[model samples]
Target: NKARMSAAGIVGFALEAAPRTTRAQSMDVLSSQANIAGYKAVLVAAHHYQRFMPMLMTAAGTVKAARVLILGAGVAGLQAIATAKRLGAVIEASDVRPAVKEQIESLGGKFLDVPFVTDEEREIAQGVGGYARPMPPDWMRRQAELVHERAKAADIVITTALIPGRQAPVLLKEETVKAMKPGSVVVDLAAAQGGNCPLTVADEVVERHGVTLIGHTNLAGMVAADASALYARNVLDFLKLIIDKEGKLAIDMKDDIVAACLMTKSREPELTS
Candidate 1:
């Protein structure tokens, strides 16, 4: 049976049976890893522009602090905000989830709110998992307008909004990118999943109307060795529950977490290029 099952199949089964970790524990681990990526993304942006992140009190003149705007309040966004704050950049963040406001504020980052009157309060009170439920079309339009206004004022914008198993919501439009200040940078963390910026091309950094749009795919993979080790540990810990005393595989199909994470259907029958 072991020989019959492919390595990929075994790994997939192991992940499904992995021991459950509390949200707090998972967030802690994810944050630690994301912080490193956030710091590096900023450094990469700065190097690309040949600009200093910190203000210089040189004999010539004083340099202004860079302004960094992070969209989304998940692990990646929060880390980006913290990293930007540490580098002396003014950090701002936005999220559909109202609960994240406190999380952003706790890190000394300002939360940008879109004034859309809705039952978000009631929804938040209910405590839904992951992100707030998707907003109505009108609300999304209003939010986009507000975000676009804010994006124009930011020197660097990092977009990290992602909906599990779904394409990332479009946050920054092409016109918004064009409206940004010359030499401004926009990093889209959702590039791998179709991106949050209309102009973003996955894994490529291209200048659009003078603004730099960086659509980085698999940003975590940039730090491969560490990322791999952390991922391996997560996999190994989960695998312990699926493997018995003799290291034989056992699968429980009824587990909620397992059922939720499993890929159900294939979009196409076969690979085509």
Candidate 2:
């Protein structure tokens, strides 16, 4: 298609475009979709779990609030924390990056601090371009140990950990799932790229060791109306960078976003008045 476009003197750009450093975040399609996915993941977990999300006081008895553990403190994970907090769940979140600790607390969720013991571990934990890189095996081992204990106590677990162009990191092991209380729910948002939980079956809701695993890959698609609206706005924002005030197609290589998105340019150039 790119070759055909070039032959036809039509310029083309990548839809999923980002420079090393982004200037305008509003034009980020991935973040927009992820925001919706995060909000919906909590709702999905709430729907599956048999018990109530919030504690209830009644003449019959007192029901305890659900305990939610969120893996990954990215855009999706942070939104999940906010949504769960609004639903009155006791939320605990873990992430490779220590920077997200404040963001987690600001949303009324507890940050499960996994201290970096080694200097190398601390440097890698900083991550790249606002995305988490794969942690060292030793760090992963420690995280898994902490997650195991936490999962046992959690009524609902949502795993959103993923690395770009790589398989999603496994935060929840099969043993941890087995240890969890019966009727607990695990929502794996990284199902498409393997899962944060090893037991997850992509796009399928399954039961393992009395725990419900939701491996839905497209949580944003579940709420299509809002997702589409947000995506459309991202596209609109991106278009403004390439189009001039007089509605002329102005390809500015100086603009980081425009340069980054330029997948193909016309070889047989066509002049526009």
Candidate 3:
């Protein structure tokens, strides 16, 4: 920002983006916002879906619970599993992180096991600080195949996978979507970042292949007050670590948090004595 606009640049995302560190967890805006998004996604899907999430034995007879498949077992994915469980949906989830299997199970969600676990796949999957890096083309092909079968059987699908600085990876292809049952729902939480489904249109719900794809951006908006409160508190907490006692902007480059947040400075430092 110091170049064109001639302004100092320090981004809030410096403390909030992916590849989470333990010390920065309290200040992670991504997780805070994602928690809200995940829960809201399930609710949104339930609203649009033609079926019920929980089984009911009434005068109308028995109703089977909806099948939910959540892609990307990150904080959002985990929360989605938990929320769906609370809603009584039979849930399954998939992610590149091997660690996510345990996480999904802990949330009472079944893990969809993809048979593409090679040494190379494992190495790449163990990305920076438990995040997922891009896998090989062969691995992606296998993942797509697995998703096709699972997505076809799902009544509600929520996709949360995303790659940093790149467009969100497409997990569900158009053909796979076409194969989904009529009246099914797919919520793409990564819609603003180019979506996890090829058919997603950012910030809009579209009907295609007899299914509803919810690609609404900023899903945290559904719970705006709570989401904003959590995100603001995180930003404030991170700012406290960097701001000097005098109250003037004094960035300590020696501090990792400061160094990480600053994108530009006014000018080069004056020579030291």
Candidate 4:
């Protein structure tokens, strides 16, 4: 008998597959979600400030455009840059990966470049797929200094640097936040992973040296129902590939990607008569 025909009915199965999507693919979805958060974060920040986002050429006087700084040119950061730019804010962004410079520029955001030499072999080995490699302490210090310098000049800063399964690297120190203009806002997207800013406390807004540090956790979960639906669909699509037509579990262990990502311990042992 064929594998599918012999096997008994299986109601459901789970696999630990790394969502089968590239950075580009994930970015497509993340951009949509982050755009909402980006726009909302700006609006939330604006409410706390005395000025407006758009310049007013009214009878009173000319209002200046808000200076918006985005740290880490990842999907969320790029979306934040674009959203802030559209809202009539001058957007500036920075990233450890120099490759993101063009991406930021394409979205009408200025990319702040910080010079650093990367080891090619080390970069390649540490980089799994398209993800960035972890940097040494020396490189991190240089990057932090550059971010601190630029952050002081901006009225608003949104940080989005994050690494999967690791603590988010600190990009903005407390000293830098203190130097920011009074009433300035910092939204740290890495709050759940210890934040990119020193003052960030997940899900709470705190004031430090006259600057508002927002460390809201699960920015995606802010729009819970929508996020849940999208994530569920992604999971369902991946599962379809592993289940047979009869709906019995048939994992192909020889497949490296499947083997590497699947969580075997989570599954209950099959009870057969």
Candidate 5:
């Protein structure tokens, strides 16, 4: 085991680095982990929530369906929409990407549109590839205004918007949270990235302003069995890029996956604009 570990020499590699290429996507650990995180987030919110997710008809009365609002239409956000839809919640989602409208509505989630003004802002909203780019302060203010209005009507809020190498933008502010209805619940998946909610405390459940804010980091970790299994599979598949068929150490620096993931070999990180 030590021999194989030493052969790869990828121990200190930043496994969380961007997996942009088709080959790299096969070993994308973030997506595997995020799939579970999104599913768990809804369950966690439902458990802590006082009201039922689905509308109920009983001898007594008809209970209204819970309103679920999701921020960001990434893998986790999409999964959260599907999971919540399964539970019969009326879902709404917001994202910077203009095309996310179709993705949200495809899963029965109403897309909250925050229109872009300037040409630069419009270009920025689309981002490089399919990921999110940080919007300028003016555009962000407009988004915050729209999000604040939507949050007030939501019974459960799952915030997943994240900007790489920066703190998660504050979507739900302290004042907004205080004004929400009693018994509302918020699951901030971006807590580890400094949280989309200002009130969130990383890895802690905060009860404030008649609402419960779950700032738990690594929601996938809550279900360790599945999370670890998927993570292990991803890591093992990535190792195949460096290991030979005879099960011997064979470092192939020419391989893109090997070159990007190789940390032991000193190389300057490319941070191009």
Candidate 6:
């Protein structure tokens, strides 16, 4: 696809090209869409879940608050934590990046700490480019053990772990789904990329071992209006990087964002202006 575009003398910009930094944050389409997806994931899970999210006390009986487990503490995961908390759910989240522990706590979600025993594990857990790098096999095994235990107690689980351009990590195994309580819901935001839960089917809601697995690839599309608004703003902000003050289309290759977004390896003559 890139070769075809370059062969046709077309200069293209990647919408998700902006680095996750304070200066270029407004132009980050990934973050914008993820924010909406995270918010929607909780709502979707609540809709499918038979039990109440918040606890209630009455003369007849008292209901316990739902336990929600979130895998991944990126933009989507953090937003999911906040949304679930608002509905009075007890949220616990896990991520390879230890840096997100504070963010999860700030949003009223408990951080599931997977201790790094080895120096190599600790270095890899730091991740790269604001995204999680694939952890060592030993570390992943440890995380899986922890997640399995947590999933059994959770009424709702949302998995958002994904490594860019790679298959999504499998956090929740098949056994974990089977161990979850009856009528539990698992929302896999990483469904498009094979999912964090092995049971998830992309764009389908399936029932396995009495657990509902929501594998909607495009959660942002579920709340289309707001998602579109946010995306359009991101596009507009990105346009400013390529358009000059005089209203002329100016592609400045020197600009960090512009350079990062350039898809064609070779510069196109038409874009030189």
Q: Quick one: best TM-score, which candidate?
A: 6
Clashing pairs in 5: none
Highest lDDT scorer: 6
Candidate 6 lDDT tens digits, 17-69: 67777888988999999999999999999999998999999898999999999
| Candidate with the larger TM-score of 1 and 3 | 3
Order candidates by TM-score, high to low.
Answer: 6, 2, 3, 5, 1, 4
User: TM-score per candidate, in order?
Assistant: 0.81, 0.93, 0.92, 0.80, 0.90, 0.96
lDDT of 2 at 251: 73
- lDDT of candidate model 5 versus the reference: 0.85
True-vs-predicted CA distance for residue 67, candidate 3, Å: 0.3
For each of the candidates, the C-alpha root-mean-square deviation to the true structure, in angstroms, is 6.5, 2.4, 2.6, 6.2, 4.8, 1.5
Shift in Å, residue 54, candidate 4:
2.7
Q: Which stretches in model 4 have alpha-carbon errors above 4 Å?
A: 1-40, 117-127, 255-257, 266-273
The digit string of per-residue lDDT tens for model 1 on 151-226 reads: 9998888988877557988999988887898999988888888999988999898989888888877667787788
Instruction: Please give the lDDT score for candidate 1.
Output: 0.71
Clashes of 2: 0
> Looking at model 2, which ten-residue stretch has the lowest summed lDDT?
264-273
The CA lDDT at 167 in model 3 is 89
Comparing candidate 1 with candidate 6, which one achieves the higher lDDT? 6
Q: How would you encode candidate 5's per-residue C-alpha lDDT over 1-273 as one tens digit per residue?
A: 434555664344556663566777767888888889999999999999998999999999999999999998888999999999999999999999988889899999999988777899988888774579988999888888888888899999999988877888888998888878899999999999989998899999999899999998979988899999988888888878666799866666677666666555323333121
TM-score of 5: 0.90
Quantify all predictions' global Cα lDDT against the true fold. Answer: 0.71, 0.90, 0.84, 0.71, 0.85, 0.92
